[model samples]
Target chain A: MTVELLDRKLLFVTGKGGVGKTTIAASLALLAAQQGRRTLVGEVDAKGNLADFFEVGPTAFKEREVSRNLWAMSMSTEDSLKEYLSLQLKIPLVARLGPLARTFDFVANAAPGVKEILTIGKFVWEVREHHYDLVVVDASATGHIIGQLAAPQSIQELVQVGLVRDQTDWMLDILGDPTRTGAVIVAAPEEMPVNETLELVTRLRDETVVDLAAVVANRVLPELFTRREEKIFERLPAAALAQAIGGPVQPLLDGAQLAVTLRRTRGVHLARLRRELPPEVPLLYVPYLFQRSHGARATHQVAEHLQEELT
Target chain B: MAAKKNPAANTRSIEQLVAAKEIVIHCGSGGVGKTTTAAAVAAMAAVHHGGKVLVLTVDPARRLANALGLEAFGNSETQVPPAAFVKAGVEPRGELWVAMLDTKQSWDDLVTRHAPDRKTRESILANPLYQNITGRFVQSHDYIAMERLHEIHAAGTYDLIVVDTPPTRNAIDFLEAPERMADFFSSRLLRWLTVPSRSRVFSLASRPFYSVADRVLGSKFLEDIAEFFLLFQSMYDGFVERATAVNRTLEDKRTTFVVVSTLEAAPVHEAEFFIAALEQRGLHLGAVVLNKVLPSSFLEKGTTASARAMVSGAESLAGAVPASVGSPELVARVLREVGESFLNFQVVAKREADTRADLSTVPEVVATVPYFDRDITDLAGLLELGEQLWR
Candidate 1:
């Protein structure tokens, strides 16, 4: 029951900036791949780190294999529109023509969310074509990506007929289907990110047809010591701990205190998060990695944790 | 003695720009604490330097709006409660103002000011294409955000204005939006697009493209777009004028652009990209503020070596049978964790420094602000961050 994300054909991973949203998206893709699903991880924005994280060269508009059973792409709205127009207008290079491009460009510039629609439409095509078992989108942060998700519906209202309306309807149908498509909101165990995540959930629930799947609580600090040990450690000030802990171990005790303080903050926030979010929206707490690097190993560790948790 | 270096080599902090420049625009990758840095700089200039400061944040979340103690700001500037400063125990010699860019309202204001009459404004505002662009479009906020800043700057109402460039998702495209805007407004193609169907004058001249677009997209979209442009026909020069003026303000000596970033590899890369983009656009990059950067001085080489030695010694000492001591294992474990934390902080610091080192090609002073344990929620918190910023 918990491995619901893997059952879906399309999964959108989004949250606030710097909250390890990309890490979670990568992990989810890995988890899908491990479950024997041929997965494609797509980054909607131009600024992407999929290549770096996978220790591969940069990905572009075209999908490239980053790992076993997994492929990655960083989609550009421009390239998407170019491909779209070339296909739709039946012209070899419709996007190259200044006048025809202007007609296509009008939607990008003057229409709200058309650029987003283009990007999503490309994914919709991949999903429709059944090229991959799952397509995971590393969308822009919560604030902007919400509008991107909603663009299909609004475009449906704007374009009343022809191939454009049919395409918009196709995207909307896929997005609205709970079993086919859903999105997870990733958050950090802190005030601002949590606040934004909560706001995003409510707004998304209200505005879009996509199901609010779950919340990925990234970088959650684990309680290292027992309750009794933590109390004894917590009561001692850094200086006192240095002496009481003894044996010239003052520096270590002081460092342990810092770690405790950080976890204490996380503990407080994590509790508040549980109390606030509805029980239906499952909370998946990714272990907080204390190390500095956010490389391939860290990403896969979280992926493994995700797999283990769902199991 | 080791070779002497210039003391003022890196003396150009962002705080100095607050005092020196009339306008300070903070540009950065998303989640690099750009809005907080902008607010911190504004509060410092308002309270410490006693300059009249206004902060215009493009944050859609209104995080800065909340931090500045405003419920929320609108297109028009709202003076931050001087009481907010007083509550923080700081008296300001000059006033502080804050605003959030409302794209639709600001665009309406632009039309209201430049449009010839009420009828034209109403039609343009009501047009579906215009409605979409003004309301929910992505990069539309960029040029409009700067336009309002230009409008406010021209009024000479404040000594310094701090702008947090909106995370419009496509920041580079947004930054270039005004040019896209100017091109659209000034283009003969748009003028052709604007031709009223009631007149047959240019209908024959532009039949090839016009008829094709009308046939392809249907009369409704073309009609709405053409009518929207027709209304803007009178106001096109005004739009172009404002764009040029804004670009001039951007290029002016009194205006400074500050690039903000966190220590993370992704953000650092984007910050470098931003700096290069600014340079490519003929805009001089003034200062780079690496925000949320880990403190490197905490564990210098000497401290690191000694801490490692101390931890290893403790492991050996704790390995010896405890003489009925309450928990020698606890001491060893604590020592290891402490050593680990120090080593962790060292790695974090080096990563942060490497990010800043990437900015070396651009000759700008790096202002490094330490990562905090909690969010800067209010003016008091912001003031504390300001101390860290200027420190």
Candidate 2:
């Protein structure tokens, strides 16, 4: 189904690791904010690359507004767990029995799905309670995305009934409802990423109930050559060009040839992807960026691009 | 002998590591092409350098499987057909086997092999309650992948076992998984949870505690935990032993870690953290494979001067184009498009080069594989990568 991403409360951006999911996620937030929405772009890992994109130092669990409408933070699982533990259930036990409480801590922390649940639960809580119109999660890559998306369900299954189960149920209500949540898979035009993106789609259909907002194809090669240029270029490999188009223009011819060839190759990959993916999946293309990594200029450029295309 | 203590140099290349190391693990954050890099290094080693190689990949999506031209891969080692190797122009003097980690099956195997007897194994594995408790063990993938690495290494069948690790949440977590596993097994809390005598504290501690737990959880929850512990308690020592062995294998000099990442800001930043993570653990460093980099030649230093001159000349020509053939507006538009793309091309190129320069401080050989014309999804494509990787 085609989803207008802005309408959804939660927008999760995920794909293969190097496919620029974080970049797209940042842009989505920027655009959402530009549209006057209070947007929170959450990063799951403590790595703090989002801060870099926004030209800020590492941020803690406390959300910081990096731009007018955009706020970003990397949630600490421990902090979330602490908040979770402080609720009505465990405060008495931890205060009374030190050793038993410590064991309880170990068991609570070491149990499978606890960390993931905490991370996701924190994000879902923001979506539920925060006044923000949009929450864009810079989720872990494809390998971890499924587990994160399904973390609530897994926890719900594990905890048949309790405060923990109730919390998971609330999180699941926000995530599993299509109108409440949507996903944008960011991918490059390359094969492995597209292959993985396709796998994510199938898993989304079968495993989760999240809506697919759009497929943001990041760093796509922009088309440059015309039919005439292409026809002329077909006969002239770099070697032939070097021999025939000698002298001052040789470097230009060479660079242009390289550019055209790369673009053509990317086009082929894009065509293949189109055939492979569902035609209905909306695709948003983000140009390859060359800006310095230390600032948010590239992100703003992408946000502007997102605004132009998304509308 | 020790990665030359220079991640900045090009001395200890990928080819050298594959030829020398008994194990090379290609690890990094997700989508950085670790599986492809590992497969390439393994194939190159087996076909060109001569060794028995087995590559263990943790790709749940099975993209690596598809890239290797397999319908699917499982826990067992599936040999790459001789014909495929030959077709990829790899004249193999040694065997190259591939497999994807089967976490569930591996978990079961760990339980069976470590259990003292068939009765305990059956009891632990079949326990309705303990099943999820253990099956979904914390950091199970990380622990299992490390165990499988040690298992294959201990077998001594393959000269090299190149592993493609699951994408890690934290670089530190990836490095510490085995230790964490050992810790989990030996933790006093685990012992308390699993041992019937030690388990009674929480259940029998106080009337209020017992009543609260029973009301919050089911009344039978405590009983289930007690029973599950009784069954798994016998296997604790065995689990600890295996975990220690796994740790030893990782610490061995014969084992090396390779960082695989794309030349992007976030991934490169993570790669830096990962390399440090390895160094902190005192692990052997092999080579870093930076994949899908823009080739240096598009506007490499040697070509930019003449290329810049030509682009200006073309724009001027666009200004003077005859109206009969095309309006100056259309010509200018085409020229502008090309100019825009070229600017983008240079931008991407600069980003990669800048990252590459930043990475030179890593003090190990760094291999830069240029963005190929197509996605690598077949054996031939992988062989092409193998060629570039070793070069």
Candidate 3:
């Protein structure tokens, strides 16, 4: 496989929950690291499955080496907030203590843009921190990734002074540039996720004005059946075969029918997605890996699959 | 007790229901306009009712920010645009505040506040295990958010606080914040484990090997426990005190839980769960806001003409149309099927409504905001949402 998109410095992978987003992210990071680029994979969601994937204990804001040339960290909003307060406010223990800290936490958690701002702020910092050559964020699914990315802009307007505002402004500039920051949407070839992917792209284009680099249609079925199999099924003796197969065959037939139905439905959604997506944006199809895509082995498989499109 | 029928019997406007409280919780599933409704209520309280209002949301998605005509909101209470309120014709009598929940920061603040000393704070923060455990505990975030809400209320900055709880995935965690706080405090396991090796328990080890084991495992264990307790101690005390006060406040009808939902089965089911959970805890179920409701009028007027026009137009334009024949009818039928499914969901919602006598009413089904055919990336979209929700 030709690795076309592999040289990119940043890869932002996101999809609906439970759609193997983490697996794909881990693989991409692994691929980058394996190719000898200093790589770091980050997750903003509360579920820190990356540590488990790397066979390490849970990680925090501090980057821990997971593999050669690859490091991992789970962004903690509280830790980031504390770091921000200490570094920005320069108020030692008091920054975290007293009414002001509580008020800050409350406001941060209660506001729509604050959490995203903090999470993305951390990413922007990592990008500029010069710790690694590439940074990959396992962003929340399509529904929220746009908002999360745009959070810095929302927050930059409120705080005019200091590093927070400066970082926000800088991050916005980086994110606004297509070459600097790339968003790759991961989706299963299903109606909801595809529709959501399309909607998300349209929104990102409209709202953030950032172009999406690619659409990764994950868990696509391989064309397993051919014309011969179709003909065989069609030519089977109707009554005798039905009787020979009996009740067990009924469920198998039902299962086959369901599979066909699902495949056809998925095909239609995929078609719609292709029709909606701008032609320039590369659409990468990753076939369904039958086994659970956990740990290094599964991730490597995904990496191999992603190698051509990524490069 | 009036002889005449109650206009509000079948349906009540959200304005009447939210008129009384300083806080209204819009709780529901994703895509149900819970965020939009929460913003509108906060806007209503600030502009119409003449009260300083704050809308707190935990939706990681900035949909709420988009709906409020704000470029973005942060962990601090940012003021809503005056233009938004004026455009909505909502007379601004008091300031409008908006914030999103950052549970981690709140949790950390709780820890730092309660730590016995600066040394203890440093030790707890430094420990890796403490960091891992605290991060994994989802309720910790909710407890901190609740604490923040109490602080906001105590500060008297805003008269009303409209909170949009995290989506239904962890609705229980948000509601059970107090209980979780109490549990964290009362649990002695961490305290027992963290006690220093110099203490009586580790002194029992006499041999050099045992002493080494004691030094390594015992100190590590104690540090872990100490770190855990140290981080949580202040939060525990504060949470208990605040929870007691807040529980009483809620029980006395000072706080209101507005259960927001859609006329859809899953959302309605989630609303029912919220109601049951609230009632079980003795908290008042203030109001139910059924959002994104397809107005019954749209269903009755079938698009027969539109369907026919599309079919004829498709035939005239192309020799062979793609996919199955009657594609327009199929699409319409699918939409109608979705509508029927929603109607069935309303049946379930109505059933739940009947079972509960405590403040159950349906607001007119707000139409689904058209996807704008464009991405909602800025404040304009949020303001557009504000208009739809308020109306």
Candidate 4:
């Protein structure tokens, strides 16, 4: 299915925790940058794994150049507050004064939506600043991302103030516009992530009017065994297999069985993914990279795969 | 000032313990009001009782930021909005502080602080393995977070400290962080690895081929270790000593460990494991905050119409139990059904809570926030959340 992902200013990637959303989001950003488009990859959680993937230690909340056309950052609420305070209040660290700064940190860290709103606010700022051709948000898990995206509207009803209200309104306008923002759900080709992704798609459809551009089925198992190869494994004498299990032949059998088990699991998950996903939403499947996705090399490989899909 | 009494407070007894500077932990399943409840309790202590409070959270979902009404938080302390507190009629007596655990940064800070000297710090920072281990390993991060908690407590900046522990799933890591760090420091293998000259001399004599193979791998491999040891040399003694102190502090009765759980099965199971883990570590379980508990009214309704329809739809289609029941409504119904079946989950949670000697009561259902149809974001949402929690 050759579906061209729409040209979007923002691509929001979210999935269940541990579903490779960050890796895929980085890949998408890298792919855009490789295509000669200036790109920024932002991680909402303060983990800053993006820098690690880029082979750097850690990027601050402020965007730092990673490559020729790529930049990365991990959003920090304290830094954002400092920026907000400095920009809005025109007070240099006075807001962080005795007792006041501590109190603010406590409240900011504890408040629900404050992190999401700030993270999103930062993304909106980056988008408006036009510093990058593409701004990719490595959002929290699917359920939380939905909550995070809904934050602006939720806060707008409450604050109704000067800057906070205006910021909320501006974010809402950007997120609500399909042309401006595109949300992609990333999932492993496993039961839990795929099931959660379907639920996420349904929830997004129900709650917000934003466009869910595609579903990226990550870590999909490629079909390596034929039906005849499966028959041969089945026909292997049980006694011989059990007796020789400690030898080289046993290891090969074990590998074959693992491949078969993985294939079966992948088949079931793929079928469900196809059935559950909205027909209109394009499904992009990324093969599982056998190598650990830690440094720049693996990220670049994943980006190569994403280039075709994004285009 | 006399303790301002309020019967309407969700957990008056719990609040009393919290106000007394007891270690109150707010934990639960994700999406529940665990973070918010923790923040409110800390706020209550700081604002009402004239007690300085520090709140520590490891919720990567950034729920604490939402609860505190801040745009974002870092490892550093930031201020809370005073207007909301004053408007809510809560007095500002003592101070409230917050820090989001940045595990890597904290670990680096610890390394820098504990390292014997500048050379040792530089060596440790230069080691690739050390960087990879600290930066990427989840366990390493959790251990550093715990180390930071101990440091903050020892600093004596706050009269009361409220720890919003990581979710129950990762609760074990947070609870055992000190011990893990201690074990890592004391590991025999690490000790052997640090003595490169001795290792190289011994390897060359005992296994010449292996030593030659090691040299072939890379000269930098040994250099990395030498640099690491040098950088970390100054702080080795201090790090081990501090780890011992932190371990002792954790084992003390004054250090309260609060287990947070939801009424749901997954969180309940997680809470059970957490309690067991804490007991094994010789830490006291102070209180269990059961968050997002469904009101008896909702549970009594048996199943929602949608859930009933799903069951019927399965029955009609398969004429038997379907291969899988995978709908949100079904998941909810199943959770409810599980809650009703053995009641074993809550029974075990309550039993565990009761067995804790330091705590005055078993698990108490403090505040039960109903599921709001809308998403919770911003300061107003958090204040609304505070109202729900305090109500």
Candidate 5:
């Protein structure tokens, strides 16, 4: 049986930038924590905005509990490398390794997959050690996510024999399994985002071992009118309606018209996404919350909506 | 402050900026329509100014790519057909060209140009790590894009070149990539990492690092990377000279940056950050193109009262409608829905307005483009977008 999304040990949530990838990842972890699972959510890019979702203070590499059964941290490759050295390699002297860690980003930049491997390795280690029931990663955007998720396999091919090579086997076993780990792609129901989502799905299948757990269509606008009502909406006399309403009604009507046009335009892409995504991949939707604020409150709303979709 | 210095310069539009500058780079956080804005501006330049215009975009939507005749990826520039302009009901005074940045191909070209010998060039191209770096690493995209832009600009083919920067992890990464590239070649760490491969001499200072690296990555992998870097060092002088030239081009007086963003919170925040970065670097801040802005009508006087009236009085309002429209019950439902929808959108529009107001230290020309109802698939749609920024 396929494990439910929340039940997975490791979940890397990624999507195109600006598609609410962080929002979805935050809410998924929030929901899992509320469901009584010990959850850890790591923001991979460290934009420091993930803390805003919970209205908490800024996060560091060290995990902090934001609420009951929930923790948050920001991934730093240097810190991840330090942790890997001490925990896995039994390197106790961080001071001696300090200079090496300082230049880690440069090495990673030159070595291609080194940084990606370190990032993924930390999360996989968390799952392997059973530190958290669920580790939801606000992973890299779609452009770089495949490289990150496939880092272990790439490293395996590059390194003939090493401790890193030995470690890749377990990381692959955990990541490649559908039950323990999966990827959630959060997409907005728009043309470019939908196209990117479809492209990423193919890339994930071809490039990474991670299974697609879910596709979250975020900020989906509501359907404004039924067929009969739409015809009625079109036929309404604008001038006459304003006179009857006792206020300028053009903007009001125009607003609805705009919404309808938006929904219609977006619906085409949504349909394409649904039709093209694999049949087994569950697609969940979170509506456009036309609120004035984003933060802890908005995250709660998103989590509630996700809960509804999941159930 | 600069705008204040030249009072008449307040009216300097994107058109004037493009005409005056050799390079106009459209940059912001991802998915804020940078590619479309750059393309639109280039199209506008071709139509009005009548010279060779090129838009070197990083990533564009598929249909927009098709519209521009960029059906495949490469560094090659293709002219957007004059027929497309005629179809869009515009006759260009000059020509519009398009190119998509293919990172791997551009890196190969860079290697070909900088390598001291054919064998070195061939070896660099064949290196497995080199292939992976060119293909997968994000920073490589930033460096190669700037490198490609410098090459094209130096060729002096286009009257105006509009560039869309890659969506970097940090928006400032690309801006600093050239300098960073130069620094990497001269850094001590590169020497340290490459030491073992050079003479098998492990100095005391580097011994601990080597020991740790060897244990984790194995000696063979280290040797492979050391060999790669040793090979890379052969062309260090040419690479550093090219990187320095790229940096100079970015700071050139003829270059300008157009910051594009929606009035959404995150994108607006990024725009603010980017504008500050540009100012800090002493680069020219030409204009700010605010894309996908909501209609000002949403925040107009007394729209809320009208919406509330519709919601509270839907049934009574429905009764006033003619029988030809719909049944009273359905009419009431539609009325309520419309009102609620308007109210919902008003909340967002108000928020957007506040965010727009929060944009501090904005450039002289801040052009706001209303959200297009449909994606810009053809030249007509692009021209429509361009018109908003032209004035």
Candidate 6:
């Protein structure tokens, strides 16, 4: 289905590692908050580098407002479990349950779906409670996202009957609804990321009830030359260029050629990604930024690009 | 070749490290070319060191298989044919073998090897929790990877084994996986969880924990978990001993870790963290291979000035060239585009230099692989990258 991504209450931003998944997530959250939506962006893994994107100090399980309407937090499974116990289970004495929780944490780690359910359950609960207009999760990379998205269902099947089993019904209701929840896969215009994006597209559809909202192709390189201009670039006389530039021009031209080749190579993969992805899933492109720094400035730059794309 | 600017900083080359170490574990955050780097280094060792070399990759793209000239290699090791090396125009001094970790297969193999009896083996194989652990647990991937490495090392087959770690949420997850696996098997929690259901429900000290767990998870599900762990408890000694052995293999003096990362902000931070992790654990950090580094050409003395000239004086400079090249307007545009591209890349290149300078925990060897215009999809290309690391 065609999706207006931000209209969805929940979005899980994920991709293969190092493809700017967190950047895309930060940008989407920033853009949503800029549009006056109360938004929460969470980093599922505890890399704790999410704050770098906003130039904010370290965030915690307690959501901190990084902007007017934007709040950021890092998911800690233990904290999530503690909250679940206190808030949902109505277990008042969290201090007394420390050993119980610690013991449960071991089971959650080794058990297949327990940790995933706790992590995704927190975000799903946020959406269900209307705590935020939108929640964007910087979810696990391509490898583990399926396990995470399908956690509630897996839990339902595994646990015959219990509080956790009953809990999955509502979480699944929110997660399974296309209007309320969708996944945004961020990919670079490279062979592996594109290949992974395509693979994940199929997996997300088959394995989980979450809808594929869109794919963000991040760091797309610019085309350096037009057909005619490329010919002109190729035919430029080496001797004249060297003399005119007052230095050897071979390395400079070679560098440009390298850029051209890199872009062209990435173009083929990008085309495959576009052609293969379901046409309804809008593909957003963000240009490769050669910016010197990569903190809040880069976040704003990405947000601007995303704003242009979303429009 | 770019002049070596920091020779004194590199006390030992990657080549020397590989020669001295029997096992080289290539690890870093994902998408930093860790798999390709491991393959390339193994290829180089097979060519130069003249003994059997094996590359154990957890998950490789199809193109990596093509790069090694193998249709596919799975749990069983497959030698990269001599013909494939010849096709890449190299005569290797030794054999290069490739294997991809099949987690499910490895888990089953571990079960078969460690299971106490035929009934226990069959029961564990049939256990639903066993299926879930093998199929979905992310830590299983990490533990199996290290376990496989230990198994292979113990086999005494290859002169050199280069393994690429699984991509984990945390960079050091696999480093701790073996110990964690052992701890999980021996932890009080497992004993408590696996305690007889009647006793668990009746015990005073555990009453509150059971009541909470029973309500939260339901008694039936807890029973299933209890039964699964009870089954697993039979193999506890085997698993713990094997995990301890794997940990020993990692800490072995003959084993060294080569952390690979691009100079991107996140990856470099992870690399730094991973290096510190290695140091803290007293694990050997043999070298750091920085992949996809921009060329130093952008940092040359006159290149920036030349690029600026091409941009600002494009029209006039186009006039200086032969008319046969193209219309002056097109030539000028081409010059501007090329010049602008150079400046753009120069910014990134400079950023890389600054990042490299700021890298505080670099080891005795720091190798940089320049950005390849194309993906490395063949043995020759792998060698091309290998040559840089070898230097």
- Using TM-score as the measure, the top candidate is 5
Worst 10 residues of 3 chain B by lDDT: B362-371
Residue ranges of candidate 6 with Cα displaced over 4 Å: B1-11, B60-63, B204-207
Docking class of 3: incorrect
- Tens digits of per-residue lDDT, candidate 5, B78-141, equal 8888888998998899999888888899899888987889998899899998888888776688
| Candidates 1 and 5 compared by lDDT, better number | 5
Please, what are the lDDT tens digits per residue for candidate 2 over residues B1-391?
3445646454667877777789898887777778788888888888877778898987666767766767788988898878877677667888889988888888888888888999888887887655554344335677788888899899988988999887667655756877776776677656655545444665664644444444444444545555676676688788778888888888898888888888877777778888887888788777788887876765555454434433555545554444444555555455444445555567668877777888877746778888775667677888788888886
lDDT of 4 at A207: 69
Q: Candidate 6 falls in which docking quality class?
A: medium
CAPRI docking class of candidate 1: acceptable
DockQ of 2: 0.37
Model 1: how far residue B184 lies from native, Å: 1.7
Model 5 segments more than 4 A misplaced: B1-5, B60-63, B196-202
RMSD of 2: 4.0
Give the interface RMSD values of the models in order. Answer: 4.7, 5.1, 19.4, 26.5, 1.7, 1.5
Sorting all predicted structures by TM-score, with the top scorer first, yields 5, 6, 1, 2, 3, 4
lDDT of 4 by residue, A1-311 (tens): 22245368888898865567778888888888877888888888655567767888788887888888888988777677557645654545443344444434332322234555676778877777787778898877664566668767655543434455557766777888777787899887665567678888887877665678789988775665355434433444434322322222222333335445656767887888988787878888787665422468878888877766555
Give the docking tier of candidate 5: medium
Candidate no. 6 TM-score? 0.97
Q: TM-scores, in order shown?
A: 0.90, 0.89, 0.49, 0.48, 0.97, 0.97
lDDT of 1 by residue, B1-391 (tens): 0122246646766677678889889887777788888888888888878767899988777777777788888777899898888888888777888888888888888989998888888888787767777776656788888888889899998999999987766556656766777987877667656666667444553644444444444566656667777778889888988888888888888988888878787777777778778877877566778776655554444556645754666556444424343366665564455566666656656766765676654655667777676667789999888887775
Question: Which pairs clash (backbone N, Cα, C closer than 3 Å) in model 2?
Answer: A17-B30, A17-B31, B6-B363, B6-B364, B7-B362, B7-B363, B7-B364, B8-B363, B8-B364
Query: Tens-digit lDDT track for model 6 on B49-71?
Result: 98999999997344468888888
What's the lDDT for residue B304 in model 2?
48
- Interface RMSD value for candidate 3, one decimal? 19.4
Q: Which residue runs of candidate 3 sit more than 4 Å off their true CA positions?
A: A1-311, B1-11, B66-69, B83-91, B125-138, B195-222, B230-236, B249-252, B263-265, B295-298, B301-391
Q: For model 6, state the Cα shift of residue B391 in Å.
A: 0.8
